[model samples]
Target: MRIEIWADVVCGWAYIGKRRLEAALADPAFDGVPVEVVWRPFRIDPTSPARSTPLEEALADPAVDNALRVCAPGLSPGENRTRVSDIAAAEGIGPRWGAAWRASSHDAHRLLFLAHEHGGAELQNAVAERVMRAHFVDGADIGDRRTLAAVAAEAGFADGAALLETGAGEDEVRELLLIGKARGVATSPTIVVGDRALAGAQPAEVIREFIARGGHRRELPDEVERLRHAEALLDRRDPLGSLVLLRPLLDAYGDDRNVLMLAARAYFASAQLGRARATLERLVGDTPDDSYARHLLGRTLQRQGLAEEAAPHLSMAAAMSPEYD
Candidate 1:
């Protein structure tokens, strides 16, 4: 099993999430489960200054505090900090957040890519642990090359400073960042196994369930590709599979005509008459002139044995397009 974690190095919840996932993998139930964990980059604050700033000063910045607010909505910055600290403490991962600085994770990500290239997932995960600890526990400025080089050496990379100076992994890291964005990675510590993602710091049991659900590797990386894949599943007469792929797309694009139409068709195929009716109603209401939507709505009503309600839509659809009859 390949588990990919998209997270920022400085994210407190991400650190805690890592510990929880480790615990899950260490459980006897998965003793021989051959899992490879790969960490991907996500910058909570891409515009964060390269130079380190005082923890309080960084917290005062809107860009910094906004991420905190996202993690703990309705809580003030101080409250969010306390909440994160408490959660981390419960996970046995006490972060030295008092004097921690907020700096860009670009350099840290680059070093991570280098580690992956050097020794694949094992070396990369080892380096990631050290890097995250350096940021969250030691309060080191991860953006600093010297600090990162030290972390690299600690992770058994001897020529780490030279590699940093040469900027060996810059392009690879940037590409991975773009890949994460393309994959719809919006939150820190988004755990992705295949195309299915569990956002935020989920519990170990939840992570276990997510893993055991058995998802294949990510073949569809973007909205267009995922939509196409869903349609292909529908074509294969796998309505449940199509619905699974469409779930996230529906959440993100519920208002989209194509998405709604596809969902209605999938629901209808799967004998979910109510959902199909509701979706078709919404689509028909939004686009009264859409012959296909009207036709689908009529068919859905007919399926529910509401022939009286289906009459006008069927007539209107046939009137608009003869093929709809």
Candidate 2:
């Protein structure tokens, strides 16, 4: 079966776990019955607001960073603050990350949903990395709708604005928490395999051994504590608490052209005209029958100060749908 991962985009341990899982999956030893990894959202900072500052001082709290290190090892939390942007550009899987220091969890979770819709676990990994890089490394404000939308556009995701406006992930966050409770997850990086519940980042060999056993046993170590504080701290209504869950899955799984066009909407909202134009142009040309594509393309073209050029696409869109302006 596929491997389902419960994690937050901002968690360093989750990143480490992701790398570990990738290594395992790539290993020639497990080549035949390879596992497809699913990145399930279990938001750690549900209450965090957009452009929120670090909880600790400017230097990053050593205690929390140490905790992550215990789970993964050799982690330097502040290091991310320095390298987030360069990493985002190089990785190209995540959105733009610059030094934006806010504690907004909504953007992180929302983009995860977007990535989920694009393909599956593979797409999720790419999407999650992009948004996280923006939040954790770039210090970008994840709380702003424009910021979120811009990041989504950069990552080739759906209109982040529409999803935020519609409050897409509002219910999903609550549901995922419930699932975590039922499964007895207490920490940031707990991974469940069938009945097996893994606490902490854990050693790869230990996780491998557990997986090798067919994952029938669930472990709740004495140190096991569920993820509680992080959620309460990050979830705020201004950005909308219920909204985080909805944001990630809307137009996620990037395979659909319509979704790509929708992502263009977010990009446009975020003022990423170049990418927005590119996405809309590609979608309109590839799927001329899609009225949504024509409409979005027309809007994108008009925004670029090409009203005459946009007229045809707008007309086609109007013809395809009686209500379209």
Candidate 3:
């Protein structure tokens, strides 16, 4: 079995997903199967400047708030550091999200590429894990060559400093990133087993089930692909484009949970509050335990001056995500 994971070192959910996959592989269900794991590069912020940003300022960005809410619903930007730290602790990694600096992971990806080239999968995995821990737990500026070199050295690279000085593996890293983008990898922690992809931080049981089923490729239909493109457009702040793509899917598969969720998000982003509310209300009514839907519905209602109605849903969403503030 071969698994390729597209993720960024700075992604908290990717770190959690890595741990979950590790646990799944450790299960006795696949005791004798030989599995090859490869880590591919995916930059969360490809255009982010190399300069380090203060954690507070980074977390305060609306984009960061939205991303955090996906993983830890109802969490305010100010509370995300604590929420991620707690998750890291539970996953057995040291907690230091509060102290971490925010920067690009481009240079770190280059180092990982070099690690894989020189020492194969074991060394590459070690370097990648240490780099994530360095960023999420040790507060290291992973974009810095010096910081990357130190991490690479600790992971058993003999000439880590020289490699960084010469900018080794930069081209390979860039190529890998291009490959990931071409493969519809818009999010971190996209684990690819054959043609099957498991997005987000899936639980161990889900991963175990996937492994048990032979990890075969399940190609997505054209409509699902369109929906995914719509989602990407929404993430890139092109709500109108997303809506244009989603309208057809909405007519064809209005009852699809993913389509409805994307439609709601598109409507919300485009300031179509009524449509957002209607779509989300239907979604929430069908899936009451969906914290994301509940939060979105609450926000939509609040925007329309229905605070009294929104309060219960918001409260429920927050209660469901106990780590949030």
Candidate 4:
């Protein structure tokens, strides 16, 4: 069976749905199955500047409303609830909605391309998960080349610099948008199995059946086992339950920035200006060009009574936020 998934990494459904598809493919039923997989291009928010914008700002933009609606609030990236997709992640065909909504698929998808170059399918999956976590969970910007490259490298990407170059390099991404339009793909998260199109966030069984039935069937569910675990944790509502669940997710995924960011924010919120500065400093070392990271770092400096030192960072952040300003 040949599985051709026409998806954008920015598409939360695609990020979530890809997990479900993987779970089904790992089934014993597919142990000996022959599968040919390909990732075609489709950009729902093709003109969204392809840059990493803060979630708060992106939500307010009128330009990509259609894209936002399709991705859904089910993919909402706020401080509180991410979504049912998150709680259902381990169940079978659900995603993790508890992350921030820094929705930009270009960087993440580009990592997959790099993964293909370095590690083939396995690496691709690893890179994909890293990107999802960065944008969704870590609340970091996947659209930022430096950030994406860091995550990719942590996921075992051999060429971090090379990957970043590709991420910042997206003439091909624009081409994919054209391909999507030509093919009549109206929305993102569209999975192409041969010529078959599977749209929206679907159940794992649907994915399994699709892959099992051979070319052009419903798609299979995500990993039932993982979703089951994630669901169990969701029901507990333990303050640290999700945190505990997040351990491995972070481990397999990239935990560096998210952990650092979470800690930095906590310190900042509590007026622990020194700690926040320290944390962000480390992140800057990892992703020197991340404007938002720099923005937060500058804020920390201002709070710490270091206005003079914060000037450059503030200047850069403002510049990045200003094309329309």
Would you list the C-alpha lDDT of every candidate in the order shown? 0.83, 0.60, 0.82, 0.62
Summarize candidate 2's per-residue lDDT along 225-313 as a digit string, tens digits.
12221123123211122223223433354455434544566566656678778878878778778897788778888988999989999
Write model 4 residue lDDT over 30-133, tens digit each, in one string: 88778756665666565556656666677677655545554454454341234545444554432334444545566556556556656766677677677767
Residue 91, candidate 3: C-alpha displacement in angstroms: 1.6
| Candidate 3 C-alpha lDDT tens digits along 1-325 | 8888899988888888899999999999889998878889998777567888877687788886676578656776557666767876887877445446778888888887888888888888999888988888788888778888789889998776688789777766865665565467878889888867888878889988876776665678978766776787777777876787777788988899999999999899899999999999999999899998999899899999999999999999999986423
TM-score of each: 0.66, 0.51, 0.63, 0.54
Better of 1 and 2 by lDDT: 1
Model 4 lowest lDDT segment of ten: 236-245
Per-prediction backbone clash count: 0, 47, 0, 27
Residue ranges of candidate 2 with Cα displaced over 4 Å? 54-102, 159-161, 216-325
Off by over 4 Å in 1: 95-99, 218-325
Best by lDDT: 1
Most accurate candidate by TM-score? 1
TM-score: model 1 vs. ground truth: 0.66
Model 1: per-residue Cα lDDT over 94-174, one tens digit each: 545432787888888888888888778988888888888888778888878889889988988777668889979886686
Candidate 3 segments whose C-alpha is farther than 4 A from its true place:
60-73, 95-99, 216-325
Candidate 3 C-alpha RMSD relative to the actual structure: 14.2
Clashing pairs in 3: none
